[model samples]
Each structure stands twice: as structure tokens, then as C-alpha cells.
Target: MIALLSALLQGCALPSLEGRSESHALKRAETADTALGRALMPQAQARPGLSGILPLADARDAFAARVLLVRAAERTLDVQYYIWREDITGNLLLDALSEAAERGVRVRLLLDDNGVSMDAKLLALDRHPAIEVRLFNPFSVRRPKALGYLTHFSRANRRMHNKALIADGQAAIMGGRNVGDEYFGATDGVLFADLDVLATGAVLPELSADFDRYWASASAYPIDRIVAPEGTAPAPVPHAEDDPRAARYLQALRESRFVADLLAGGHLPQWARVDMVSDDPRKGLGLAEKEDLLTHQLQQVLARPPVASLDLVSPYFVPTAAGVDVFSRLAARGVRVRILTNALEATDVSAVHSGYARYRKDLLRAGVELHEMRRGAQPQGGGAGVFGSSGSSLHAKTFAIDGQRVFVGSMNFDPRSAHLNTELGFIIDSPVLAQAVTQAFDRDIPASAYEVKLDEGGGLVWTERRDGQTLRHKREPGSTLVRSVWIGLLSVLPIEWLL
Candidate 1:
């Protein structure tokens, strides 16, 4: 490992995107999105400042919104994400971007390096003249992949956890879901109950500016420069959908009814004011020494230290001592705090669950209502979530404050989001949205979650409703003994900060 690390250090240094920085004022009607951009401007201008906020509760709506936005964009598309897997979902999105590029729509894709493993699809996508791919705080090693991480673990540990898709500088989608099947609810195994917002009013420019800052920042490394044996960006050429892999992706895109719905533009609303919030990308590189986090900014925007209720839904919930204290104080003040997170059976990452389980008892003792999402929790109507399959885990990082505010973003209620990852989200002061999200929270508590309570003996009891039948378990659901052992062993490890 030492030799490999040494070799990586001796390898090519991180490349530069120096001359690539170009600033252009956001021209609304003048841009290529003339068809759609022009039509929305008049109506968008009339609505307060920036409204038209719609919650993408359904995974199909979220994915389709992105695809439609890409298709509708005629001027430019700025897409940024923490994880952009080279999976079925990823390829289909890429194919759509390619078609948009073919039409001369300039597409900028800014992805976190830590979230991506260097591969052929990324290289191929980066080659498009109309498409530009930039990696935030990229790794140096090109040959022995893992060596780069080991050598620069400190720097690589911090990641850009922001996810947004902006088109024509007029519309955007920002939230917890990354570019993958699981996020889209297409994964055959476990599906994440994620949240995203489809907004098309005044918030787009704010998102665009943030995208440019990271794109031109010192950290953004062009993909061509990161991979060694530097290859030329592939020239604009014929569609590669002839390849079997490419065909599969294109086929999914073609058959999706969401494609038609989004193109019609009648699904989402077109009015309301939304405050756009994002952490500077420098936060990921530790250069934001004096900078406040997006979370802090969100707190200020929320303007409520102590509220009547706090409904939080986070997949990876590791409330450290500080978090516990916050919840404990809220509970003391008669504030109802309801939290929903993945159970041992549903979590994709065991370490996160281990870290979170440590605080379950603490929270319950403090009067904070805690619900661990069951592996097969379904809506009361037995309606399947996006995955519409067996396993379902909570991935939506959102919280409703009081009954008038809601926050949905990539910021998980964990140390990684608060301290390490640069995150983004919207703290909309829409009571309508807040109520909807709050209702969802309340529904999940009974139908799709395990209400954790303490028995008279000071032990944990998980009460869950399955198939219209209520059941109680004294231990962790499914694999009780084995899961306990796994979480117990992992909880002892000193890695809470990573979670």
C-alpha cells in the first residue's frame, strides 16, 4: 500500500481547468430555450418573486422532470451531483443529455470525484463537444485507483454532497436523490424514499450561479485531465445507441410516460417564492475556514430555534451528542420531534445504522418520537413506493418545522453533512408544502415505520404494522441476533465522525 501510494504521489499531478472559466450573464428570453423560456418568463414574472414550487414525491416525477428539463433546454444545462453512477439510470440520463447536446444545447455536468469511480462511460460522456464534465476535488491516482484515496483520505473525506439539475437558467431540481436506479426507485432490491423539488420560476439563476462557482473554482478538474494517458474529447459524432448497452438506456427513456407528462408542462405548479440555499463548494476542500454551513444558513432562514413540532426524515441518522441535546431540549419545551430513519434490515450502509442506533435510546428517553423504517413498509393503501418492490428504506433528507416550513435537500442529519460534505437544499416557507410533508411524516410513523419505545424494563421495543396487522418485536426486526451483533460491534468502532 505504501509503495502504491508513493507511486501515485509520483504520478501526474491534479490537472487544471484554468482557461475554462467563462462568465456570462443569465439572459432569459435571448437564450436558445426561446420556445419554453420565453413562455414561462411572463407568467413567472407575475408570481411574487420566485414561486412555482412543486414537491416531487414520486420517483417517476423526479426522474421525468430532469429528463424533460434536459429536453426542453435549448440554451444551456447545468447538472451537478455528488454521485453519478454509470448504471442503467445514469446511462439513460447521459443519452438524453447527448441528444440535447446534438441540438447545440451546451450541457455542463459537475460531479463529485469521490462519488464516481473513473470509468469508460464518464470518459465517453466528457468527450462530447457540447457536454463538459468537471469533477470536484478530484483524486490524483489514475492507475491504482484505491491508492489515491488512502494517500489523500483527509482531503477526499470531504465531499460535495449537492445534487441539482438546472436547465436554460430558468428551472431546476434539487434534493437528496443522486443519479442511480436506487434513487429513481428502479433498483430491484432496496429503494430509497427520496425527495426532490421541481421548480421553474426565479430560483434557477441562483442555482446556475452556484454551479458556475464550482465549475470555475480551483477544485473543479476537467475529466480529460484527471484520467492519465490524456485522451482528446471525442468529436461530436453519430449516436452510439447502436451498442446494446446504449440501446437499453435509450429504450427506457423512449418508453417512459414521464417523458410525455413533463413535456406537456401541466403537472407542476407555476407560482410562489422560494429561498435558494447552497454551501460554497470550498466547504468540501476545507477552504471555507470562516464560512458558515448551508445548514446554519438554513437555520437562520427557518428563524425558529424552538418550535411546536419538528418532523425529520433522514436515511442515515447518527445524532451525535449535540444533536441529542437539541432534540432533548426541544422535547423538554413540549415540542414534538418525530424522526424516521432506516432500520437494520433496510439500511444500505451498516456503519451508518450502527452509529445511529447508539442514540435511539437516548432520543426515546428524551420524549423524542423515533420511528425506524421497516424493510417492507408500504402506504396504507398498500401502494408501493418508487421501487414498488420488497425492500424500502428512507433516503429523503427533509424536515418540517412547526406547520409552516419544510426543508428538503441532500443534507442528512449526520456529522458528514454538517461538518464534511458541502450540501444544498430549499427552506421554503410554504405552509402548503410544509403540511404535505408533515402529513407524509405522520403517515409513515404508523403504516411504514417501527415506533421505537421503551418497555418497563428500559429496553427497546419496536412496534410495526404490516399487512394490516400490528406486530411487536423486542429486538431488531428481521435478523435480530445477527443484526444486534453487527451493530454492536460496529458501534464500538471510532468512526461516528465519518457517518
Candidate 2:
């Protein structure tokens, strides 16, 4: 396995390290974080900015703000991702990062080493002096080709499944969206199950602290350390400057008719009140090093007496036996618990559903409301064609309790997010925000999902609420067969934690 990892990483060479002039961007970045500092801190305000649950059905508004933040950055910019394709969206982001670095901004980019196979433009970014990139838990191969045949047990089961961008130590965007078109709903004939949170306040400091911790961790390797002296090693890419259309992928994206429709959709609803919390400092807020804050907090909340209603939306739901016990206890307390997760066929990760399938009966016995997003919904734009026909999946992760509190972040409802990978999100203690999120859930639940009900034969059947249609299979006509085959094959792979 070590041999395989080494080959993959070596073939997907990182940028060579050359000393670059240091700029004063760090100081400016510090000040920016401080300017937005007070609001993120819990002691300063009950909520920051306008905190409301919003339905982000498109990419324009959020993407525009993201670009602006990257452009406005004056000092340090830290970005981490599980995937960063060399597509239009990826190029746009890299351009912004390059612009920031050219202005003397200290930029650090972290990406999962496993995804190097899909990266075609990673080496080019290394030429910039102000930018430093690292791969998390990189494989050990010194050569390329045939590395896939080797599979080591170590790190082979671990992954850095986090999505975060910290600029000037104050503002951050954290959630499910990665550096991919599908993630932002900008891909052709595809829409993803994803969510993200943008914040400018005290929470920025906490996120920065985590970024610094991870940046300095043993798992990270500076780009300079990975690349050999210029003339010493074989070139990974024959020509860097010769790649004339490196950023042309975005143009293809523009050609997609659905892309325009999604752009026309309105922006995410801004919250009038937002509350931010980091897991207690003693535990590093349950980031990478410990139990995930999302899972730990969810466990704690479940321990309490039941509330009248609890609504949950998670794309990946893999409940363990103990977890089911906790939820069952809540039901015993009279709390009307309801949940929405990707159905078996609608899921992008079938192994997660496999784990979840083991506990479904237990959850149903405990009286939890369960629903799964359907294959189609009114496209973000007015009408739908291939975009609607694609068997889209659920990607949002959220929880609402008694319409009083809401949690949003990059964390998923799986063992990786709960006990392995580093994750982050916001916990708002506002009835108004909770109500908005809950209302959005109510509307979303009815149209795009099906409620799971127990039939007379003691089996589960899906019921579409819109037209009262009932179906057993999750696959719908025109679904992406490639995705189905991919998920099926990946689900059988033993190393789910690594994925």
C-alpha cells in the first residue's frame, strides 16, 4: 500500500519549493480578522449579522461573494479542500489566489493527497512565490505508474475531508462545497447535495487557529520539500506555459444552459441573527484531533429530554447501534424526531448507506421521521431538462430542535466526521433562524423527497408526496448510470474511511 501511495503522489508531483520574497500581507490579514472579530465571539453578541436559514439553489451570489473575499484579501489566505479540479471554477479560484499572492498575500493551500489523480494543474500554482501548497497524508511512492495496485493500511483509511477558506484571519466559508462544478451546481447535467456557511466574526479566529494547527501538523509537507531540484527529476508535465487553455474549462461551463438558469436564481437568504460556537477550547472544538464537534454536540443534545419536534437533514446518514439507542431514548421521551437522508439509490456514497441500513430498523422502531430526496425537482432555474433528469442527491447537513437552535457546517453524519476527520460548522441559538430553516425544510421535504413509511408487510416503501406516487427502487429514468456504477463499485471497496 505504501508503494501505491508513493507512486500516486510522485506521479502527481507538487510544486518545487523556491524561496520567495515575503510581503506585509500577513499584518493586513491580521487586522481584517480583528475587524470582524467581536461578532464571532459568543461574549460579544447573541448573533452576528443576519442569521437565517437560507436555500442556496444557485451559484452566482455565493460564488460572487467568494470571489470578492478572495480578491479583497490583503494578507494571509488559507484554503483547504478535498477536491480541486482544473475546471473553470477551480481556475477562477486559483486566479484569485494568484492575484492575492501577487499583492504580497501569504497564501497556503491544503488538499487531500488522494485526489492528486484528478488534478491536472496543481504543479503550475507552485511557480508563484507567495503561494505554498501541501498535500495531507501524502502517499510515499517515489516513482509513478502502477501505484494503484499497491494499497497500504495506514492513511489508506484516513482522509482530510474538510472544506474551509480563511482570509485575513477573520472571514471564512465552511461547508460541503468543494472545488468542483457539481458542488456549486455549475456542472453540466448535474447538481450536488451540498451546503456551505459564510461567516465574518469571532468564529474566524477559531477557524484560523485550527488552520494554523493543521498547517503545522506532522501530516503536512511544504511544496518545496516534495519537488526535486529543477534539472534533477523528470518533468511531471511536459509544458506549463504551453498549456494555452489551462483555464478554458470554465468556458464549457458557461455553455451549459442550466448554468445560466442557476445564475438567475436569487442569492442565499441572509440571517438577521447568527450565533457562532467553537467546541470548548479544551478539546480544540472537536476538530481533526478529537471527536467531531458536530457529532459530539449531537450526542449531547440527544442525551437531553425530548422536545416536541426535531428535524434533521443529512446527505450521508450512517447511524451506529449506540447512536440508534440514543435516538430511541429521545423518542421514549416523547420527542417527535424526524430525519431526511439520501435514499439508497439517491446516495453518492453507497457504503455510508450500507452502514446506515444496519440501523434503519432500529431508528424506525424508535419512531424517527425519515425521508430521502428524490431524483428530480424544479431545477434552480424556471424549467428543467437534463438538469432535472439527472438523479441528483442530497448534500445538505443540518439539524433543528424545537425551532430554537440550528447547526450548519461541513460536517457529515458519518463516522469519519464524527470521530476521524476535522470538521466545522455554526450553532445558532435563535428561534427565528430555526423557524426559517425548519420552514425551508418543510417546503423542501414535500416537493423533492419521499417519506419512508412502514407497510403492512413490515418493510419500508417510499411515497412521493407531490402526486402520491409510490415506488420501491430509488433509480429514476434518465439517472446517471455512470454515477450508479461508480457508487456501486466504490461501496464494495473496503477503504471507505479513506474516501
Candidate 3:
């Protein structure tokens, strides 16, 4: 039995990338005559060097934009994400991609192996001549995937956290969202308050080039190479017309004017100088140079410190000792650094909250303001707005600096984003968008989040304003004592780097 087990494990070894075909994204000229290109070119040409940016803060609109982009693709569709759940919206998007392929649109789907598990469905999708599926940093052992971690911890630990969708090298959507029900507000469970932008013009090519880099990287293995051949792909999941959630999303699709306005040339975006920043694909193998990392690039781009205000919204805000010092110095210099992150009961990952919790007092003492999003904090008007819907947890990773610039993307203000996973985002020189974030901090944030402050005794206190009354909690609100104790225990551990 032991010998057989050893042989089975040995057989699970990964295949080599020798002779893998190299493919590049279609050039701008090749897609200039495409439908999406035709609709967006005039505005793009007018701007010359600026990219048209339409922030998809509404969850429904964010999902609609991707679907509409896929439906409009003429030449090719390049899609990449860390997670693609097999739920309602995920299946719908998969079906849409397959439909696009049926119409002769070449579909290249790259997903992180750790975030997906539908081997049979993915292998089936790979069978389509028009569609190709690849997994990033895939596990060798199919069953009991933990075995791969034991065998190749170094490689398996690093992930491709970038999310993007490019159509015919003309238009793209990039941001903090993955393809899942939670991301799109299609679930009654924990909905993620995420952000994505529909971008056109100068940034499309750069985003496409970045997708190509990741798709062709050594870590990306074709699905056939990872999973064995399965029978014909299962029939695509049909739209659940009967499910109330599905009906609601369908209504949202009909209500969303984002794509329609773009196609009709009626929607004008804030044309600005948008710079794309991404971690080198080599970072997945721990081979990227320090200068090539996204952190260094971000610092170089936003070189000057914030002169006025810094409003940051990160779901997992683990500002290690270094980050605390930076924020402390910023506050000392009179920068109004206000951060909004998930509270303990609201966070999807409790471990991450521990990492952020340990530094709460230090940050408050430095004059930096802290706001913890309350669990189930629905957006005003009961819609799935940028801050999220009912049963929502903050998943957006964004920040506005000095009220003159803003950043929207997948990079989080955490150690893992700094040194572990590859990340992507864009920095835009748009006061309009930047102030929108700051305005939210001034208005909606105070209503939905708890204010963390240092009391007279130097201990932390959480103040909640609800239904015209101000409430105070000595302990973390909505979080149980045992859970808090567990988090405290985790805070003392040496796992901040992993958070």
C-alpha cells in the first residue's frame, strides 16, 4: 500500500513548459476596426494620450459591464482572475464567454489554480477550439491538493492576484473583483463591496500587454497539462429565471445604462492620464527585482507625500510596523489619513483582522483616523452601491491621495500584496474621482462604520452612530469575546507576513 501511494504521488508531478506555444495579444491596428474599437476610438482620438475611465462602483453595473464587453468583442477576449466560482454569476459569465467563442471570438481564460476547483468543467471548456483555459501555479496532486503544498510550498504559496478582462485589445475592465456571486452582489451571503472600472483608449493596450505577460508566464499551465481529459464539457448552467436573486440581477442588467451609453457614445468618462501599475509576473517565482515590484513602482509614481488628505479603503488592511510608521509620519505632517477597513464581525477572513487589529491603537495615537465597517451595512437606498449591500463586507481596495489623485485596483495595503502575490491597479490624475472617495469618507462612511479612537486612558474605544443615537462599546462591537480572544492570540503570532 505504501509503495502504491508513493508511486501515485510521484505520478502527480507537473509537466514541463518546454515547447509551449507562445501567443501574444492582438495589436491595436488588428482590432481598430472591431465594434468596441469603433465605438470608443473617436473619444479616444480626441483625448490623444488620456484614457477614458468609467468607475463601476455599483455591483450590478460592474457585472453588466463585463457581460456587455464580452458580448461586444469581435476579435478576441482575454480574461484573467484569481477566483471564478461555479455559482450563478460565475456560470453566467462562463456561458457568455462560451457564447462569444461560438461566434469565433478567441477566448483565453487564465485563472489562479488555488482559487478554483472545477477541474471537470474547466477541462471541458478547454476542449472548445475557440476557448483556451490555463491555470496559474497549479497544484500537482489533483485530489488532496494539500499534498502539493507540502511538496512545493514555496511555489504554491505565491499567487497571481491580478484581475482583468480585455476585449479585442480595445477595451478593458480592471479592479479588485473576481468572478463570483459575492463580488457581484448576487448572493444573500457575504457580498463584497468591490470596485472595477471600464477603461478605453490608451490604457487598453497596456492592460492587454499585462494579461499577455501573465498568460505566457512560466506559472501558467494549460488546463490539459494539469487536469486529465474529461468527457465532453457539461451543459452550461442555464439562467435561473425562477430564482428571485437571478430575477433581481436580471432587472439590474436592464436598468444599467453603462454599456448602452458607451456603445451609443452618450457616456463620457473622465479622460485623464491613467498609469497602469502591476507587479512583474516574475514575482510569482520570487525572481522579480525590487525595483520591478509594484510597490516600488507605486512609490515612484506617487512620489510626493500627501499634502492634505489620504483616504484609503482596503478590505484587508494589515499595516505592519513599517506601514504604521508611514501612516504615523503622514499624520504628524498634517495629512488627514483616514482608513476604512472591515471590522472583525464583518471581515471574511478573521485572521486578516488580527493583523490589522494589533496596530489600531498605534494608528489612532498618531492622529490617523480609523473606521471599521459594520457587518451587514447596506448602502443607502438599499441598493448595491460602492460600499456594498446587505450582509456586505468591504472588499474594495482603493485610496485617494491629496484630493487630487486616486487609485483603483487589486493591490491591497497589506504585507501579502507587498511581497507575496502579484498585484495590478491604475493611478489616475483625476480630482473628480479622488474627491468622490473623500466625499464618501465625509458622508456615507461615518454612517456605516465604527469610529476607532484612543480614549483618555490610551486604550481603544469604538463609537457607533446609529438611528440618531451614539453608542459606545468597550470591546469590538458585534464580535464575541471568544473570537476577540482568538484574534488577540493570533496577533501575537509571527504570521503578519502571510496575512
Candidate 4:
């Protein structure tokens, strides 16, 4: 049994690729002439410009933005993500992509293989004449999740967490939000406070190159080759009939403030000076460390010789000992560090919160400000506005430096992002972009988050304001006795690294 367990845990090589023809972006060598391209390409030739979009904080606008981009892109669309659900948002996007393909526009979709259950939907789309799908580091066993994980734990655990949607190689949407009901605020119980940036120009080249590198890597296998052979159906894509819910949702999207303003057509184009930063393709396999990871690049960028202040927002923040040391050094050097993360009741992953609970004191001792998002509030009249219809949780992985630099991407500040998965995002050197993100941090922190302070006796106390009243909690807010016990129990486990 021991020997079998050892073998099961041993890392395995990625699946062998079949003889698949190379399919590059639609406007590979030339420029895109679509609506997006015509609007941005000329200025892009001059320099990269980024427009920080905040309406996504409200879920309706989030999905609306993606839909509008799909509708406007005439030449090509490239999508890469970690999760693509088959729910309202996911199905809507898929149907849109299919329609775009049927219109003679080329489409490329890439997804990570772990926990992928939308095989039929993905496989059907893969068969589209103008669409192709690939899986990053797929499993040999298509079903029975446990057996596949046990057989290939080391390989399957490392995933591609990058999220981006590029149109015509002229502009792209890059950020931390994934394609799911919850992410777009379509989910009823919770809404994720996330971030994304719409960009065009100089960064588009690097972003496209990055996508091609991973698409051509040995780790990326053609979806049809792997999924269809495992007794799964793969039929040619057909025309997508209108979904009634999708129709109603589309109508609502057109009426959204963000899109309505866009349709009014008087607003000029918004752009920013930007730099595209990411990890090497080899980082996808965990073979490379700091030298190739995006974190290392960030460290280098900050090392010359650091910014005046930093604002960090991550849903899962388990800063390891080394991370603690880094933040401590930054604080000692007079960098005002403020961090916001999900509180106990607001977090989707209790285990990660357990890992973070241990670091609260360390952060406070180092003079770093700590804030936690409160449990989600009830949906106000089933509101679909920017803050989300239901309660809120921070899913945006972003950092601001001295209110002049901003980064929004899939990488978290935890060990998993640092050492395990491949990540992607861009850092912009625009004060306008930075200020936008900073303003968001300042606005949301005091309104929906609990500010944590070290009591004179070294205990933690949380304070917040709600409904014209100041609320204080000596224990974790919303934590029941059983919850407190479980949190304590989880904190003692030796699983901090995984969080």
C-alpha cells in the first residue's frame, strides 16, 4: 500500500499531443480592422493605453461587457480561463461565441482541465468550423474525479489560472474574474467583488504572444482528441437558438448604465500607458520558481527601490512566513501597507481563512493595516447593480503602488499563486488607473469591511459602521461557537502552504 501510494503521488508527464494543425490568431501578422481594432490600433501603435473598468463590481455590467465585446469583434476572439460553468452566464457566453464563429469569425478557447464538467458543451463548441478548444494539462481519466487526482496529483494540481479575453489582437480584457454565475453576479446567494481592465495597443502583442506560447506547449491538448475518445459525445456545433433567459438578460444588459452610456456614443476612447507582465510558459509546470514567476517580476519592479505605499486586495490571503517577512520589511521602510481580504463568514474557503487568521497579529505588529470584508448583504430588490445583487466577497487580486501603478490579475498573494499555478496580468504605469483602483479601495474598505486593530492586550478587535451605527465585535463577527471551534481546529493543521 505504501509503495502504491508513493507511485500515485509521483509527478507524471503531461499527455502526449496528437497531430493537430497549428491555428494562430485570426489576424496573426497583420492588424485587426474590426470596430475594436479600428478604434484602438492606431493609438496602440503609438503606445499602450488601459481603461480601468469598475462597473464589473456590479455583476450585470460584468457579463454585459463581455457580451458587447463579443458582439463587436469582427475578426477574432481568444479566451483563456480556469473555470467556465454551464449556467446562465457560461451558457450565454458559449452561445455568443458559437454565433460569432458562425459569422466567419475565428475563435480560440483554452481552459484548465481540473474540475471541468462541461464536456458536452465544450466538446460541441470544439467541433465548430471556426472554433477550436484546448485543455491545459488535462487528466487521462475523464471522470471519477478522485481516481484521476490520486493517479496524477502532482501534475493535476498545477493549473493555468490565467484569465483573459482578447479580440482581434488589438484589445483585450484581463483580470481575475472567471466565467461563472457567481463571478458575474448571476448567482443568487453571493456576488464576488472582482476587477478587470480593458486594454488596447502595446500590451496586446505581448498578451497574444503569451497566449500562443501556452497554446502550443505540450501541456495543452486538443479538447476533441482527449474528451471525445472517452465515450463522450462530440457533435458538430449547430446554430444557437435564442434562450429566453438570455434574451431577457440581453435586454437588461443593453439597459445597464455602463452599456447604455457606451451606446450613447459620445464618450471618447479611454486608454493608458501600460506594460504587460507575466510568467514564462515553463512556469505552468512548476519547474521554474521566482526567476520566472510573475511574483518575481513584481518584486523586481518594486525593488527599484519600492513605492511609497501599497494597497492589496485578495480574496484568499495566507501570506506565508516569507510573505510576512516581505511585508514587514516594506512596513519598516515606511511603506504604508493596507490589505483587504474576506472575513471568516464571508470567505468561500474556510481553510484559507484559517491560514490567514494566524497572520493577523503579525501584520498588525508590522504596522500593516488589516481589513476584512463582511458577510454579504441581502440582495436589495434582487438588485443587479455594481456592488452585486446579493452579499459581497473580494475576488479581485489587485495591488496599487503609491497611487501610480495598478495590477489586476489571477495571481493571489498566497503560496499557491507564488509556487504552484501559472498566472497572467499587466502592470500599468498610469496615475489615472492607479487612482481609480485606490479610490475603489478607499471607498469599499470603510463601507463593507471590518478594520482590525490589536487591542492593548494583544487580542484582535474588529470595528465597522453599518446603518448609521458603529458595530464592534470582540470575537470574529458572525462566528458561532461551533464555527469558532472549527476555525481553531483548522488553524493547528499543517496545511498552511496549500492555502
User: Which candidate gets the maximum TM-score versus the true structure?
Assistant: 3
Q: Choose 1 or 4, whichever is better by lDDT.
A: 1
C-alpha RMSD between model 2 and the true structure: 6.9
Candidate 1 lDDT tens digits, 295-397? 7687668665646888888889999999999999999999999888888888889989989988888999999999888875676665533222233777888
Colliding residue pairs in candidate 1: 51-272, 52-271
lDDT of 4 by residue, 1-499 (tens): 9987776545333445767768776452365557776666665556424442332456676677788788787878889999887777888888889889988888999998873677777888887889899998887656665565667666677888999898888767788889887787665667787777666666677788889888887778888767654354555433223556666666776666887676565434445656666777676666765677788788776666445888888889989888799899999999988988898878999888888998899989999999888887432244432234445677878888898877778889888887778889877777766766576556646767789998989999999877768888888887899988898899999987676
Which segments of model 1 are wrong by more than 4 Å? 1-8, 16-18, 21-25, 229-265, 384-391, 480-482
Whole-structure CA lDDT of model 3: 0.87
Per-residue lDDT tens digits of candidate 2, residues 339-362? Answer: 878766677666676666656667
Q: What is the C-alpha lDDT of each candidate?
A: 0.77, 0.59, 0.87, 0.75
For candidate 3, give the lDDT of residue 118.
84
Which candidate do you rate higher for lDDT, 1 or 2? 1
Q: Better model by lDDT, 2 or 3?
A: 3
Score candidate 2 by TM-score against the native.
0.74
